[model samples]
Target: MSTVISHRLSLLEDTNDQLKQQLESLFEIGERNEQRFVWLKELVLELLITENTNQLDRTLYSKLSELENIDDVLLFIFVTKPKVKLKHIRDTSLSEVPSRLVSLSKTICEVCRANEYRSIFNVSIDSSGSFALIPYQFKDIQGVLAIGSSEPARFAGRVDTLFLDFLGEVVARVVSRIS
Candidate 1:
C-alpha cells in the first residue's frame, strides 16, 4: 500500500510539472501580444496630446523609431479635391525616399477611400528597406503614416490596426476643431 501511494504521488507530480510548463508558455504568448497593443496605444495618446504640428511630426517619428525592427517613420498628407497631391510631412531618415514609396502611398490612399477602412500596406524594397504604410483619415483630409525598417520582415503580417484606427478618430476630432 505504501508503494502504491508513492507511485501515485510521483504521477501527480509529473502532471503538475506539465501543467506549469503549459501555463508558462501561455503567459509568454499573452505578454508578447500585450506589448504590441500597448506600444500603439501609447503612440496614439502621445500624438493626440502634442500641440505643435512640427513637434508632433518629430514625436511621431521618434516614437515609431523606438519599436523593434522599425528604422524610420514618414508622414504624408493627401489632398484630393480640385487637384490631388501628396504632401510630405516628415521622415526619420534624411535619405531621399524612393519614388516607389510615393506611388505606394497614393495607392494606399485610394484603397482607404474606396473601402472606407484603415489599411496596412507592407512592402519590401530591394536592398533598401521594408515599409509599412498605415493610412489614416481626418474629415476630408487623408494621410499615411509610413514605417520603414532595414529588416525585411518587420511589418510583414505584424502590424496591429486597433491603435491606428483610434489615432485616425482622434485626428479627425483635432482637425475638426482647427477647421
Candidate 2:
C-alpha cells in the first residue's frame, strides 16, 4: 500500500537526518581537536626553548593566559633545590595540604567547585566559579596547574581534559629541563 511505503520513507528520512547531524558534530569535534594539537605543539616548542625558570614561568603564563574560558592560571611549585629562586611562589607550604588530597602518584586531571576547594586556592575567585586542576610530576619535581573559569559550568564534572593532561606532561618535561 502507498501508506505503508510512505511510512517507511518517513522512517528512512528521519534516520538519514540523524546520521547527518551526527556527522556534522563529528566534524566539529575534529576541528576542535586539530586546533588543540596546533596550539599545544606551539606551546611545547616555546617551553623547550625557554632559557631559565623565570623565562619558563613567563612562557607558561602567557600560553595559559591565551585560553578563552580560563580566567586564572596558578602554578604551585615547591623547588627543593633552587636552580634559580622563583619570585612569585605562593607562601603556602606542603604542610598546608591535607594528606588525603594529594596522592601525587595517581593524581589526574580534576574539575572542582571553587567553593568546595576554597582551602587550596590562595587568591580569591567567585564562589560560583569552577576549576580544572591538572597534576604533573618530573622526577623530584611535582606540582599542580590550576585553571579557573568564572562560569560555574565551564569546568563542571569530569569533562574532556585530554589536551590538558598532555599539556601537563609537556610542562613536567619542560620544568625538569629548566627548573
Per-model TM values vs. the true structure: 0.58, 0.81
In model 1, pairs of residues that clash are: none
Quantify how close model 1 is to the true structure by its C-alpha RMSD in Å.
Answer: 8.3
Weakest 10 consecutive residues, lDDT, candidate 1? 109-118
Error of 2 at 136 (Å): 1.6
Q: Mind giving the per-residue lDDT tens digits that candidate 1 earns over 14-119?
A: 9999999999999999998899779877876776676655656666667777888766565655443222122225322212333444444322212122111112
Q: Which has the greatest TM-score?
A: 2
Model 1: residues with Cα > 4 Å off, grouped in runs: 1-15, 33-38, 80-128, 158-160, 167-179
Clashes of each: 0, 0
The lDDT for every candidate, in the order shown, is 0.54, 0.68
Q: Pick the candidate with the highest lDDT.
A: 2
